[model samples]
Target: MAAAHRARHWSFGGVVLVVTAALVAAVLISFSGSVAPRADAAVAAQTWSDEFDGVAGHAPDGAKWTLETGGSGFGNHELQYYTNSTSNAALDGQGHLVITARKNTDAGLGCWYGQCQYTSARLNTARTFTQAYGRFEARIKIPRGQGIWPAFWMLGNDLGTVGWPNSGEIDIMENIGREPNTVHGTVHGPGYSGAGGLGAAYSLPGGRAFADDFHVFAIDWSPNSIVWSVDGTTYKTLTPADTGGKKWVFDHPFFIILNLAVGGDWPGSPDGSTAFPQTMTVDYVRASSSGSAPVARPIRGIGGMCVDVAGASSADRTPIQLHNCTGNAAQQWTVGNDGTVRAFGKCLDVAGGSTADGAIVQLYTCNGTNAQKWTYTAAHDFTNVGANKCLDAKGNSSADGTRLQTWRCTGAAGQKWTLG
Candidate 1:
């Protein structure tokens, strides 16, 4: 799973409904002080009841996170020397995790290649707090000036077994000082990996940068989908179909990591206009499960385009065609807890599994296969279980003449299908 293989299949629909805006605004307002939720009048809630409780305002107390140090360069032309000791990384008492990069006069004892001048910390939950599906968020205020790139992200816990993009990378929040107001959320995996990986940038309203205040950046991950949100409002989604015909790398467990880099190819270096030793103040970090519940029902296709099965055919490559209606395994679908939808034991797959329109739909083995993963968008559209291709008719043909196929989504109602 190379990072470039995670490129998203782009599509634009009507403006997202503003329904979640009010709720997000309220959460931001309530986040001013400690993020404690009100208790019932009869019973007092615990102090850490909020999502980020316990993990904020200091170096994580529990053994859930490990701080990585040492002068090992992380491939980036960074100025700071990474140290494993807590001396350089600690709670500033003002409620900020300070990871300072200072120019040193003598780089003798702490030197890596030779005279190393700076030292900072990289924290990770690689040994603790690995989770599958849930909502993850962090509220942080960043330091200003150039050459600063801060990130809050997750890596598949199976990194040792799978490696790199194959293990998957979920970047929940990433920002460079130059692009202050614009934050990125990305997913990197094999096939769609690299600079154009599956990702999107969310800009603050009125061109506001996130450095001045604490903002909530989050991601809602389910078996079949990954939704990126800012302040709790979903702005982007990535599905299996978006990555061609690969496996859905998100079903397994992943651990979190947070770091502030001095310079990188993406963020570049600080010029004369840049400032140094910038800090990213994290108010808190939190993770939660989707809660114990039964899997949701699969959406059924309607509008008289149901496939009609005449009789039992050979299991190998048996093709079923769309007709009036016929309740059969070839037509009926069963969505599994792992976010895969199967019919006749074959996974539902997009034609050529391509993001382009008119791609036919087919069935294949599940196998944690990415093409079998589908995402239901708020617009009631079914995107490729791997990529973002929409389940569409060959054209906008409502008549029987239109062939059922997958196409690059235009976000039309005809392309919308209900997952019953």
Candidate 2:
């Protein structure tokens, strides 16, 4: 699990100290090859695209989704009552699902505290659309003002068997009215669970509120990695290295969830400035996979530079530099069904398992560890084999003298790595 907090409280030093401590603590948490005989003629590689022509609507086309309602409060001290009713959720003629939050005066619709005062809806696709690896996205306009919490997220359908963080939750978009234009995306799993889970905020370029208009929020889920983007601009990414001691919760199928809640622990209660009963409009939600297939064959003797390596002994850190891939056991990797990469019997962990540059890479045994997971991008950079840092070169150098490193990536050429 990974998390980020609003920087409203701590001073710069205080924040740095806390992050440093977290990195130090991460250092202490020490945490597959296959070839297939192709039966069919090779097909053209699928070009990436975001077309939602076949997506299901409110009723959720198939078993891909289920409605969740009437829980004893979803960790937040919310006022609205949750119900599994189509009346609360429906598709508008404009090709969108409208989940409305309304004041409910009916005494029959009661809450655990007493008579219900409000009603809302939560929809998920755990059964019907559970996917292992794919691109997931939703175009939505959030509700504004204090106390409103609307989210577009994913939860492992294995909750009944695996339980909570172990099952994993990927929050693609979450906005509390108080925060307005700032939308948050995050991943939740064991080890890095709760308030400190893996996540980040993407404020509108000029710092505008998301409630103002519909925006596309998405995550590209590949074997062992996840990348977050807003309107096509990459903001953050998470790989196996970010999972810490937790299992690689993202490897299985996850269903979608969309809900609007009123007030909670994180967003707090509505203040005098808050408006009543705001609304969240969702244009559509889409999921796409890399089309089920075996790993591509490695080009013999054609080495690609390592660019980044994690999990080496501290003494070997400097020498564990990037070199051309020689199809060696060290270079060959297998992305597991559970979205993790396995190689050399260890994980491709990030240095200090951090998202910052100059972080060292160290290897450790896998225990669903986040540090070992990674996301490979079309841009060729390998993000956290566990969480969100991207592979980077020290100071943008292609020179042999330049050190290889991981850094807060800007998608620069020097940070890109390729495999053939």
Candidate 3:
């Protein structure tokens, strides 16, 4: 999605405004022995919105959006000249906004590749609105033709200073005419951007083209997580652990953007048979807010050590150990609604799906299997669903790198956890 990667990553964090060098180094060790819970709240309330109510031929709400006019390619090597004109974008008088891309040979606009061959519109809410974690979504019927591209995305508010990639970006939906039945959701950040962005694609069944109908595209974003869906089908989820060794840059506010480009590096150029007046119709767009920001505090246990991922590696099979509280992303765990305990984009899995007395716990890809599912009892026991065993500091020891394992439900100090 780097082709559309507006710029994006994450941790067990909530709306972080800044990241200094010290903070980066402290990722592994949480000082003060604070025991904090993994996460809280999902889509809470409607914080900001625009329903496109207006007369026909009117432009987008100027109070909420700023139309960006440029032909410098916007770093995408696109062909269209973005203009602030009603000719390119306007309300349809029926609760919908239509963004039309017209082939204009004589637009009389200065562009990176000489005279512009097309005209379209790009609108953003940089100055008027920004949100950190929430449900961001839109419903639209896309225009289809060779080289026609349309996107509903977001970029970090610190764009002017931090710049692309580092500023973060979340592409809720992007479609290229070449893939008539498909759309993609992506996150781009420092180590992962442009062509290397981490994301997934969704395609309509029955060989149906997205241009033939309006589809609901969205992302449910929270601390340390971003889930993407198309018409209610969840396709992908991203987290800080997915960025390799790079920083998770999605802890701040990001503004929304909607645009339709005629041609670009991703969709190529319009062909002779391509339609001239291609239109992208948007029915609505909305963002919901998160109630309480989730804190990825350390989970302290026996001897005052925290539950940790050995070596801070996100690779599958990484051991879950007992280490002196380090506030690093590797030690941060978020409790998923599905009863799965997660850290570094993976789940706390029973090794080999073992149901024995001494099976060690490890971080592995989250599958819906019972081995990866568990319930934290009121008494502080992390009991595995399938094995009916409780988490234990191996051999009741509290030493560093003491691997944790599952045992018969025990109320001993080794099995008790102090969570945030």
Candidate with maximal TM-score: 3
lDDT of 3 by residue, 321-359 (tens): 999886887778765446667775567999988999989
Put the candidates in lDDT order, highest first.
3, 2, 1
What CA root-mean-square deviation does each model show from the true structure?
A: 14.8, 13.1, 7.4
User: For residues 201-226, what per-residue lDDT tens digits would candidate 2 score against the true structure?
Assistant: 88897877788888999876654457
List runs of model 2 lying over 4 Å from the truth. 1-64, 291-420
- C-alpha lDDT of all candidate models, in order: 0.57, 0.58, 0.77
Model 1 lDDT at residue 77: 47
Worst 10 residues of 2 by lDDT: 23-32
Residue 381 displacement (Å), model 2: 18
Count of clashes in candidate 2:
44
Residue 337 CA displacement from its true place in model 3, Å: 7.2
Top lDDT model: 3
Shift of residue 145 alpha carbon in model 1, Å: 2.3
Model 3 residue 173 CA deviation in Å: 2.6
Q: TM-score order of candidates, best first?
A: 3, 2, 1
After TM-score superposition, what is the CA distance of residue 97 in candidate 3 from its true location, in Å? 2.9
